[model samples]
Target: MKAEKDKIVSLHYTLTDDGGVTLDSSRGREPLSYLHGHGNIIRGLEAALEGNEAGFSSSVQVVPADGYGEYNPQAVFEVPREQFPPNETIQVGMQVQGESPDGVLNFTVLAVNEKGVVLDANHPMAGKNLNFEVEVLEVRDATAQELSHGHVHPHGHDH
Candidate 1:
């Protein structure tokens, strides 16, 4: 079957940055599987894989907007140190999570000082181009259960 909405696609991919630094990959592990057109993957990658069938292989470049989105300065803010666990030692570059009105937000620590802690909610990959070398290993129609769940289940449904 071709990769389209509701189709499950299994693929091996090596993700890299513009400078060719490897970021992530499925080389030594099982191929990643996801339901097509379900937003399970990035927009640019889904667009590139659209209408393709199994056995397809290609290198795709995804801009920031299509990948993680351009970094928004508004997402960076400072919060009083008391917001975090008093016992926790906050450090720069460490990832943390905060509860917001919308939902839980993941943030990276930008700076920590006596005044407050600076956190950036933007994804770590935001504002950067992503390079993907992908090989589609298999493609098939998603089962009714998979479609209902909006994602692929590599193992039998246990959730």
Candidate 2:
């Protein structure tokens, strides 16, 4: 079967940045599986996978807009240190979840000072172009339950 809306796809991929730094990979692990055209993956990669069949392999480049999205400087802000639980340690690179106008947002700590903590709400991969080397291992029609649940169900299991 070909990858399309509501189909299930399994693929192995190695993701890298523009500088060729390895960002992620499915090597040495099970191939990633997701429902196609349902926003289970990035827009660019999903678009590229459209109409592809199992055993297909290719390298796809995805821009920030189609990936994690362009970085927003306005997403960085400082919050009073006391806002956090007193027992928690405030450290750089730590992720903290908080409520925002749009909904729950995850923020990364950029800096912590005596007065306040600087946080960035941008996704970790925001602003970077991504390169993906993909090999499609399987493609099949999604089960009615899988489609209803918005994800793939492992073999031998029913939900």
State the lDDT of candidate 1 residue by residue for 99-155, as single tens digits. 879999899999999878999999999999999999999999899889888889998
Off by over 4 Å in 1: none
Computed on alpha carbons, the lDDT of every model, listed in order, comes to 0.95, 0.94
Identify the candidate with maximal TM-score: 1
The 10-residue segment of model 1 with minimum total lDDT is 150-159
lDDT of 2 by residue, 1-159 (tens): 999999999999999999999999999998999989889999999999999999999999999999999999999999999998888998999999999699999999999998899999999999999999999999998999988888888573675
TM-score for each of the candidates: 0.97, 0.94
